[model samples]
Target: MASGLFHLAVFAVDGGPWEGPVSWRKAVTFGLSFGLTLITIAWVSSFVALGDRARNVLLGVFAADCVLEVALITVQAWRRVPSHFNMETALDTTISRMLAVGGGVLIVVLVTLTVAAFRDGAPGAAPDVALSMRLAVRAGFVALCGALLSGAAMIARGVAEVQTGHQQAAYHVAGALKPAHAVTMHAILVLPALAWLLTFTRFSEARRVRVVAVVSAAYGAAAVVVIGVSAIRFATA
Candidate 1:
């Protein structure tokens, strides 16, 4: 999170419009988002029972990739060039491909974690807490998949535009799904945190589960609406 705040400070000093892929906004957003996401995944993973070596390896790679992604984006922002889908130079092409490949790595790690969330129950918690954690983690990972899908769409669309000689349009059109991407990305934190917080309340175990269920449904509904709107905008764009 400090990385994000530092970028926010940089953004203040740099003083530019907050739109565009190359803007300070990208640095700040990626820094904060990736930082928080790493933290959340680490926390949620504690509840699941994975082999130590495998878990450590996966998380280590995930952490490195998150840092690498944010660092590249920040570097490009400072260089004042488009960060993704830019092939004007050999360097830009390399960075763009690296980012794309990093994205694929993220998907694989998260998908593995998501499957584990469903396949194994939360260990060492009260039954209610376990149940809540289960629901929250599953829902959170699913929401995260939505974010990944939207991100993939953006990259695919942008790459197509870049390939067609419409370089500037590539940047603009690629962000058509930003709303959905942003909205769905953090459910992993929000839902699990919500479920965790409910544990301290007077609500009974079954009631807590019910509450998580209702909130999960509400979150799903919101995500659907956002995705639909983003899809429309993407189509029109």
Candidate 2:
């Protein structure tokens, strides 16, 4: 997070449009996004019953991958080159492919954690808290999966355009899903935090669960609308 803030400060001082692939915005956004995501995953995973060694290994790899991805983006931004779908140079291509692979690793780790969340339940908590944690974590992970798929779509479309000799179009078209991608990615933190906050209230377990359900439904609906619009735009682009 501090690194992201520093990048933001630099961006402010340097003053550039935030729309391009090589913009400082990419570095700042990825840094903050992945950093917060790492923290959220670690927190949420604590409620799951993964053994200590397994948890450590999974999170270790996840954390390292996040850092690597962000570092690559930051490096490319500093080099004044696009970080994704840029095949102009061997180094750029390698970095772009590594980012894609990092995304796959993220999906695997989160899927494993999500499965554990469902399978083990939140041990050593009150029933209400347990239920809230379970629903929040599950729903969050599902939304996160949506985010990942949308990201993959963006990369695929961008790479395809690049391959077809439409380099500039690749950047424009690849961002078609950015709105949906951003909206869906943070559900893991928002939904779980909401559930946790409700636990401190006087609502019964059933009421809390009901509230979480309603919120999740609303979130899902919003995600669907964004995704539909983005999909249309992507297709047209």
Cand. 2 Cα-lDDT: 0.87
Q: Which residue pairs clash within candidate 1?
A: none
Per-model TM-score, in order, reads 0.94, 0.94
Question: Where does model 2 exceed 4 Å of error?
Answer: 121-129
RMSD of each: 2.0, 2.0
Question: How much lDDT does each candidate structure score?
Answer: 0.87, 0.87
lDDT for each residue of candidate 2 in 1-237, tens digit (9 for 90 to 100): 777888999999998988787789998999999999999998887766677777888999999999999999999999999998888899999998999899889889887887777664344422333687688888998898899888889888888898999999988897889999999999999999999999899999899999999999999999999999999999999
Tell me the lDDT of candidate 1: 0.87
Cα lDDT tens digits for candidate 1, 1-237: 687899899889879989876688888888889999999998887765566676788899999999999988988998999889989899999999999999999999998887877765444432333687788888999999999999999999999999999998887787789999988999999999998999899998788889999999999999999999889999888
The TM-score of candidate 1 is: 0.94
